[model samples]
Target: MNAIPVDDDSLTWGVPSRRVAAFFIDSFLIMIVTLGFAFVFAFIHLMSFGLLRGPAHLVLLVGLIYLAGWMASPAMATPGQMAVGLSVRRADDLGRATLVQAIAFTGLLYLTLVAGVIWLGVALVTTRRRAIHDMLSGLVIVRAGALEPRPW
Candidate 1:
């Protein structure tokens, strides 16, 4: 993806609060989806007489992949992030993030959340309002529509 020139003014405005709200919204949505998957997996396991072991164990991994997939898509935002007017981009050039970066971001984000949620405090001190995962993955959270559309 070509790097897009983004103004800090457009990228950082009111993002922190929007991020918090997006987190809650995403978490709720994830929970609902996970529950649905669990039920399906349970049914499969029963039908197989417990021989298949089903896919219950992969739920968490699948959730992470789903989040990463969204981050790397043309939309560059999870459903919740899109709903809340936020997008994720490469920190260095404001380009679309690769799948690897998105996966790293998703993994690190869960780790940060698991680690007492204190890591998020770093965003308060950072100039760009970026969280630990955002910095580690070389990604940034910006306001939706902050990036110009690709000409292609």
Candidate 2:
């Protein structure tokens, strides 16, 4: 993978706004996935005399896991983040984030959602535009393609 320009000021420019957009996009995608699963599960639920309702709820968990995997993939961003030209990186070295970090970020992100989205407002005031989960996970969201690979 190419090295990211961690030192460039432009790396974080407009991140807060882009992140907001990405949030909506990702949410919609997740909703679609959930609905699709729900539809199939509902049919099975009927066939199985309502015994499938419990497993149907697992769709949410699967969606969360998928989101984390996407974030930790080589692309370094979720589908929504990629759509908005944003990427996640390690806060300490701007290196690609590990799967562990991505899972942590995803879990905390849902926690923030449950606690009220006001937590996201932190990005507006933070120097790096990081949300609470981003900070806790030691990751930063930046404008993708803002930094070119350093010829090392």
Compare the candidates by TM-score and give the number of the best one: 1
Query: Candidate 1 at 42: error in angstroms?
Result: 0.4
Cα lDDT tens digits for candidate 1, 80-120 = 89999999989988889999999999999999989978889
In lDDT terms, how accurate is model 2? 0.87
Tell me which residue pairs clash in candidate 1.
none
Tens digit per residue, CA lDDT, model 2, 66-86: 778888899999899999899
TM-score of each: 0.89, 0.88
The root-mean-square deviation over C-alpha atoms between each candidate and the true structure, in angstroms, is 3.6, 2.6
Give the per-residue Cα lDDT of candidate 2 at 117: 91
Deviation (Å) of 3 in candidate 2: 6.9
Model 2 misplacement above 4 A: 1-7, 150-152
Q: If candidate 2 were superposed on the true structure by all CA atoms, what would the RMSD be? A: 2.6
Worst ten in a row by lDDT for model 1: 2-11
Error of 1 at 137 (Å): 0.4
